[model samples]
Target: MTSSAENSGQPVFTIIVLGASGDLAKKKTFPALFGLFLHGHISPKTRIIGYARTKMDRPDFLKRISQHIKNTTAPKVKTMLDQFLDQSTYVSGAYDQDSGFLALEQEIQRVEREAKIYDRLFYMALPPSVFIPVANGLKRNCYTTKGINRLIVEKPFGMDLESSRTLSKALGALYREDEIYRIDHYLGKEMVKNIMILRFSNQIFGSCWNKDHISNVQITFREKIGTEGRGGYFDEFGIMRDVMQNHLLQILTLIGMEAPRSSNAEDIRDAKVNVLRAIPEVIESEVLLGQYGKSEDGTMPSYLDDDTVPKGSKTATFAAAAFHINNPRWEGVPFVLKCGKALDQQKVEIRIQFKDMGNAIFHKDVAARNELVIRVQPQEAVYLKMTQKLPGLGMDTVMSELDLSYASRFTNLTVPDAYENLILDAIVGEQSNFVRTDELDEAWRIFTPVLHKIDRGLVPVEIYPYGSRGPKHLPEFVTRFGFERHAQNYSWPETSQTSVAQAVAALSADSKL
Candidate 1:
């Protein structure tokens, strides 16, 4: 594969994965760590210790991750592949007791004894409820006295604001804040990582990146796939808590916050936490919740009708909510975040609409605002569209976009999947790729009122067809806030009216027959 000693300061130790046989580990966590090994990006003696409740041999564990690796291969991954794989070992450790944890501890000790390394990283791939017990057991029985015993845990930190605090208190008792790395893979996305660089490194951008220059921010993380066989989980958490609460809020904080005092983890993380804490208290009028109904052909199952979900489930499959940062820089600018399952297409994008330029006498109809769109998935790119004079006799101006797409612009540039990046961060001892407890609490704070509103029936559950773009009046809701589909007062001629009229006229003709 790659060169093992290429990295200058990798942690000199063994690493462990709790629930190593789980879906996240089998599909994502292992593949990501293996990517680091294949690239020669880790210390030569690093041993990955996989501990799970399931009884499996080392070969079985190794067999589980082969398909995921080939599916996400880097161009330089072919040469040193075996060397990377040689570092991985598997063991069936504790699920809910101390004896199993002792074996896991001994395994880590044996790995260090065999390979002669010290640093230990304990990663939990189990559900959130098991996180506290696993961390406590690891701290009490598993951690070696030699080096760092860092913990990495996955998301949905809590159901709401109150639970988030409770979970944080629980975690704080076992591990120091710095020792706990609450991973949000979205924080590892290439474009999301680039957002800070795009804002601070560019001179022109830094000057106008404020409330005075921007109007509103619209974020959408849409998925075309329905629950499939996951209706049980989808119905319980809903789209709001699943996506908008943590992932979307993190993005908004990145785009809206001021330059951190410095680029260090503490400075950047502090800025994010501060901004998230400032999200104005939510109200009922500013939120919209919805669920997908049965499809027209009656072929697709509705959310409740899915065999896995309980009947008459009230959890929202779709959600649109408004949040405002009380800070002066983003006072009046509405931060609209919406996400859903089984409606529209799979798209994750951030649209920043700049304020319209005031009267420039030379052109009365040329007040079209500029927009900066950051594409986060399927394609990673940054686009800024500005209005300029066209090369024509009429002195007309046309809007043109400046684009920077990762696939097209970067040769030899392979942005690793978020999971891969996060896993690498842990190996390299970088906590910037993770979320802190304060950030988690602030994330829940922004949406807790909205969650309460949905719970108390203050916000109605709007329903729409299974395979459509969310609620029918969704566009109207945004329009009421002095915002529109494109931008304020920038009208485009209609293209859908002819089709609607033709359908109506044809229906009339059919009825007459």
Candidate 2:
């Protein structure tokens, strides 16, 4: 029982998950904990306590969380899961009331005493309405003084700039800046984490990461499904708040930030903050908003079709905006952030389109500009779309890729869930990947004006078929920002019937003079 403390010479770690009975907890939080335990990132003595208002027995609670964990026939997975469940227990509690918090505190104390645990992490998976109350309750009733106490908060941090600052002010009073982890799960993504390394560590990329060589940068998040039954929640925040504001903007900072002085977390965040400060507030004219309608065949439902949605709701399920950083490095280049639910496919990617080859030997139509694409999910990949001669005897040029598809390259490794990586970072006190207070404030500043406009019916919401790409003007909108879409057809070789090795070899052969 004390082996974790004995082996590591460190105190046991405990994670107290608020809103444990909620969907986010069961689907993401617990499964992530199981991942960390399976990977041996946490001490075996680690204790997981789930607190929520719903009353459920230990067995029932275990059943709910375990449902989303990977289903495997492997005995090791099963054993690890059983052990994870063994270390976890549930407590019923009201978020705001003192009585429920007192019960939660007692249970936590019992675990700490039994396991000799000293550290605690509270993950808030509840609605934003309950965030303040739960934070206050934990601070008053459950905060541990003997060891580290960390709080992990999820977002829609607030509806807008004023609200975000208000929430930050309240939380700051309760917890020191270092003790709070504002979770923006996108920061935990494999590719997003790789952005810094990809830019600074590589000379070829580092040399040209500027307005002079790069035409435009696009950070896109697309979902194949709509809000489903969560229209009420979706309507309030809309796509601007839900996806573009936090997740996509976080990606932009990583892409646009200068190299940090050192690898220290604060230095890295300082670099990101500088990027945020350079970005001006979004202009409503530069933004295109859209809400999904029924699919072409009328089989799929629209955003307003959900009974939970208001009849005249104009909440945008799709948003595309052009942002310009006024810094010397990226003065004129547009950083376009596009996000939509109920689109053609599910993909999250950062597409950096380099300036068209100038004074080139090839005809304009023959060569497409080099594009460095980082596909973040469904199949993680970082591929460069470059020009090459067709493999045949002809001089015709073709677009090919220098691809590093994770599936093809890292065949044996399984990428950890975003939550798992972030939760582990919180336990170890790493803040580089988490958003800071000032970073949150700056992010809100960029989006608040446009958000307010949309809320007040000043901006129009275009409607597109649910299964289609997005608003019909999406192509034109992106084009307006100087993002050129090549007319020639190009596809990622890794997705085709040809193997990655074969595709790379063919490209190598074609490149020969």
- Report per-prediction Cα RMSD to one decimal: 9.0, 3.7
Q: Which is the leading candidate under TM-score?
A: 2
Task: Point to the candidate with the largest lDDT.
Answer: 2
Clashing pairs in 2: none
Residues 1-513 of candidate 2: C-alpha lDDT, one tens digit per residue: 233334465446789999999999999999999998888888788999999999999999999989999964579999999999998999998888999999999999999888878778999998899999999999999997777889999998999999999999999999999999999999999989999999999999999999999999999999999998999888889999999999999999999999999999999999999999999999999999999999999999999899989998988999999999999999999999999999999999999999988888877778788999999987899999988888998888888889888877775688888999999999878899999999999999999998999999999999999999999999999999988877888777546324756877888999994
Candidate 1 residue pairs in backbone clash: 1-79, 1-80, 1-81, 3-40
lDDT of each: 0.79, 0.91
What tens-digit string does per-residue lDDT give for candidate 1 at 323-371?
8888988888888888988786777989888876776664534646788
Alpha-carbon shift of residue 71 in model 2 (angstroms): 2.7
